[model samples]
Target: MASQLNSGSDLGFEADLFKAADKLRGNLEPSEYKHVALGLIFLKYISEAFSAHYKKLGEEEYADQEDPEEYLAANVFWVPPEARWEHLQANAKRPQINFTDVNTGKERVGDIGNLIDNAMDSIERANAAVLKDVLPKEYGRPQLDKTMLGELIDLFSKVGMHSADGKSKDLLGRAYEYFISQFAGAEGRRGGEFFTPRSVVQTIVEMLEPHHGRVYDPACGSGGMFVQSERFIENHQGRRSDIAIYGQERNHTTWKLCKMNLAVRGIDADIKWNNEGSFLSDAFPTLKFDYAMANPPFNISDWWQPQLEGDVRWKYGQPPAGNANFAWLQHIIHHLAPRGTAGVVLANGSMSSQQSGEGDIRKAMIEGDVVDCMVALPGQLFYSTQIPACLWFLARDKSANGHRDRRGEILFIDARNLGHMVDRTRREFSTSDIATIANIYHCWRAKPDAGLGAYQDIPGFCKSATLEEVRKHGHVLTPGRYVGAEDAEDDGVPFAERFAALTATLEDQFNESDRLTALIREKLSMVRYDV
Candidate 1:
């Protein structure tokens, strides 16, 4: 999303805005400051949408502008009078006074923090279905600075979230996305708990081409997958209503972030949250999705393995008690529609590890013809951990999707050498890199007349391996073993000539070593005589 805001040599307006906002965060941790700033941004987006709709309804012949359903019908969250950005901004610098809470009747001082908290509560009450328990109402906390809260609201008031022609809405969406990424980076390892790298999410969306269907993510962190998928559809000139999104996240805070993220983009999704998580409490249990994408926590040791000992989702095999890699794989597989295709990000070990029957589960999935493709990713692509990762493409019926029939073949792409370093400790896939990888998969899967061009194996890069070839390697799915090393360039020297030169060089080095040894011994002997 930050990529969209750049204009050649300039960092663009959103980047500049985020920098200014970060500067106002004096003595506040990014973790806490993010909630404050993002809450305001979310409020701004919905209020603008409501105001636009309200204006239209007022111009109508006999429309009721005050009715909440009028805004709800247009897919706009109804921002009550007290919760509107203008109201909050108007009272931003209000002096402290005795205030009574309507719900609790608790007498409190009317400061900027209390006013902001009340505004958040009013918004939630007006639109409970979408905003219930999602908006952060912690601005009144004693630790937060009231003056800074008012200043932050004033800062966001300058952001033009809506325009008469409605072109600025897209800009606002991009800015929201950029802010999410910036916050994720600032939060470091904790950030990865709620955000996936934008490039990685883009690559997954490009590969799946989830153009129109039910898309789902079991561990939907901040709903990045849904955002990217929406972008893909919009970029292709498709209608947003064509796709339905479903997601589940264990973390309540991240779930609220996901809700706000999707709401700001005006993408309606059924994102559920609970403490039990997707593993133990399977939300959306009987539903199957057409496209599923997830970056589940890698190598998790406590995924309620004992509680789910005989779960039906473990059709491939029971995952080891000490690891949940196979469990995640099977859960995704179980939730896939008959024609569903999924792209999963997992630790590289999932591609070849044999520990605790993971290899057998992999073997079963491969033999079942569900494993479509495996791509080894470059390192430093994640903010959470530095563990090398890979993408596992699973398709329930690859042969039926107007694609070439290759049921027994799996595509292995060794992309460990692909992405470029973005910083000292991070790497990202360039536009060309993402296109190159996605195009390879498309070509390999497209039918002859599909216009994606013919697929061919490139040494040390990609290979279409047969099941027999896979079995020979003990069902190990690491791409390197199958793709082989890239061929080296010839230096115009004959093999015999090179061998002769190497041996000659070795002989001269040996002779030099012998002379040095004799010189050292003679020196030692002279020193002994002196003693």
Candidate 2:
């Protein structure tokens, strides 16, 4: 296990950058400042990308340097002249601002905030298809301090955001990820809504290995799942173009964040947003995906369950109207392709709860042979809630795909003791912890020739249990039930010698007690005689 938290002075450039940006946050709450800071970072990223492409187009005789289509064709967001980073940086120190609205021909006078707001607008208008309403345009709000905003812009400007030809796209992307994580930590519960902790996301991506085909997340908060899946492909030397991305986010602000988060990483996704959410709206309604991963709002009580009766996604069983835990599970299952696999994060109760037919649904899913594995994770891994959670891994077709036929088997991993505390309140899986868990799954699912080692049951850590064993436990999916207690270490002393020593100690204690009793009786008799 390893710790990810660092002191202000120890965390290198990103940490120092975050601290500097936060100082300028003065009166704004983290919730508000999050948009302010992240919006600028996103703006800087696109501008750099556009500028790098613009320089190349300028050198080519046949290319139109100013053509928006040229940048769009290369999957780059076109930044208009007024919206470029260089222009913004140059104007950061302006004492007074004056600009004419291109659409209305109206003169606007304010400060740097107005300039940034306009820049955000221009970028959106220029790349309407990809960025239509994604960028935040509220920098001109009255509560924001102009001086701090200017300084913040200047601070970001000093950072070398681009290489000569934009080869450092990932550098900015990584920084953006770090910022999102930090903001989540700052915002606490609300932050967890938009961001899944990186370690947890990495574990899922590594286990699923979404190398190709379509990947989807119905509750795609800030698109962390999609980002990690793309990174997984790149890390493993797989072509990112092999997989298409699809997602839906109900929160309007979070939806915008997801779009920018993906765009910064050069990932094209069909991420949709609707107030009705995935349940009522069903954004990717008719599409089946090769892989689906999500960390939906846990145990949501007001998921509009009264309106979801007889919903087509409830193939296993109807989820209780009060809690949407089972609803999320069935929804993910519904969207899985014929041979698709899925990994989902849910409350621990979902694994063993018998309330409102949830247990029955688990039974049906188990009997159907769709449940592949269940991992019981440690607590304190989330910024959202303190509730312990588990990972549910499902496979649509287990007996096919050149893997061993695992129809009646399920792997249970009790990882509640694996991770180390990163801080006083938070815990995260280290690189080694993630690799250990993923290796178990891969070995269990892979063929012998795949080069992953053969899977073996480690007592109290992992166990491959038969369906009958699951049924014997009354359909409870808690990993501790199947994996059993870990074996205790053996001391050098033999059992006979240990027992003899214990008896000797007990005899000495008995003898001492009898001597004390006799002395007390003698003292009492002497007192009686004297009386």
Candidate 3:
């Protein structure tokens, strides 16, 4: 649950820092304590950013340091002196302030908790448009340990090291993301409600390569998908402005976490939340995105309603009320632009289950040719469930839209044997493993110059099968059905040549069957006359 996190080169911190912070958590549940800890981290980042920008402006000739416009232009939150990190930390152990209750309208002596609460209020007031109702203001609650709150402030002081490294302000976000992962592990099943394993999100983002245009996630959880997508653009040296983010989370507290998570990283997104969820209440009903990436809850049974039976998003068919695997898939597919592509995570049963018309829906999608590729992942790759899962890559266009014309072929990758164990119960795909899987996909999509090399099947690892082949196997898209055993002999020959040989063998079998049927009828007629 802890890591040796070093920001830039000159500034670094050990895992002990997080352990110390966790110790201060004391009797508070992670669900409640996350806001307290994360809020302070957010406060630290903005305060430091504003103070640095403020000082730099003051040193410049004819510059106004007090103008909020200057800080807004620089993408830094303008923190009032009373709300600054130094001001809060200086008064962490004690406070001297007259506080008025917003609801009660009465004045009272304030403690350190009330001081911090007022600080959050001032920040939100100054940046009304962006930070409105976004920060947690429950620090004054009696259950919070005032002493422990002061200790947490001390623990997060190490976060200041990030500002010294001269890196992007997003380093704090990395630290924030790591802490969320730890909390997810500690909370077990309940944690899965808001968090997805990092490797899984990384692998999807790498494969999709969502560099530009509108990016979306309907079941966004804690907004990790959006964060990773933005990071992808940053890593590839692309323009961040070229990417616009949109998402929707159903859980209220989880949605708040998503907002703060983005705010710390300085990522602007349109993330919506509603109790009815994405299924019953569509937030972006008409907005088609260029790239959609999501890891929705696995095999949810209560997602359907009577109203959903006739919904237009169910283009393939109406999903049975008992399961919503296809519902999420169809919703994503419906929102894709003409050339948009998406990567979705779902339970392994989605590959071959015929129950409740699921098989018919699979056939419809295959016949329609929206399914671009399927990947079977190793078990324990998720923190939420251990049923095993697969990634479904859907594309609205399979023609040569910058890539080769792949209208009737689907790439199958059996990565079930790839990832290594990261802990006693969970497995993760290493950077090398992710690259191996993603690069093969790119190669299959484009020609030699487009990817690492011209696409070639790796026998046990990947295979590109035609529509006819899928039909032969009853439209089961499991990678295991196409990407043969890993132990299968490799002759260093290309897949097309082997496919041709297999086709000839299939034709011979059909011819022999016809001849035997005629012989049997002739023999049966002879016996009947004798009898």
Instruction: Estimate the TM-score of every prediction.
Output: 0.88, 0.88, 0.87
In model 1, pairs of residues that clash are none
Where is model 3 poorest over a 10-residue stretch in terms of lDDT? 486-495
RMSD to native, candidate 2:
8.7
Residues 1-531 of candidate 1: C-alpha lDDT, one tens digit per residue: 233323323338788779878888889998888898888888888888888898999999999999988888888888878678888788888867454564575777777788778878878888788888899999888888878877777777776676567655666677777788788788888887788888899999999999998999999989999999999999999999999999999999999999999999889999999989999999999999999999999999877656798899989889898888888889999999999999999988887788899999999999999999998888889888788888999999978675788799999998878899978989999999999999999999998899889999999899999999999989988887788943111232333678889999999999999999999999988874434
Please rank every candidate by TM-score, starting with the best. 2, 1, 3
Model 1, 509: alpha-carbon shift in Å? Answer: 27
RMSD of 3: 10.0
Location of the lowest summed lDDT over 10 successive residues in candidate 2: 1-10
Error of 3 at 253 (Å): 0.8
Using TM-score as the measure, the top candidate is: 2
Pairs with steric clashes in candidate 2: none
Residue 30 in model 3: lDDT:
80
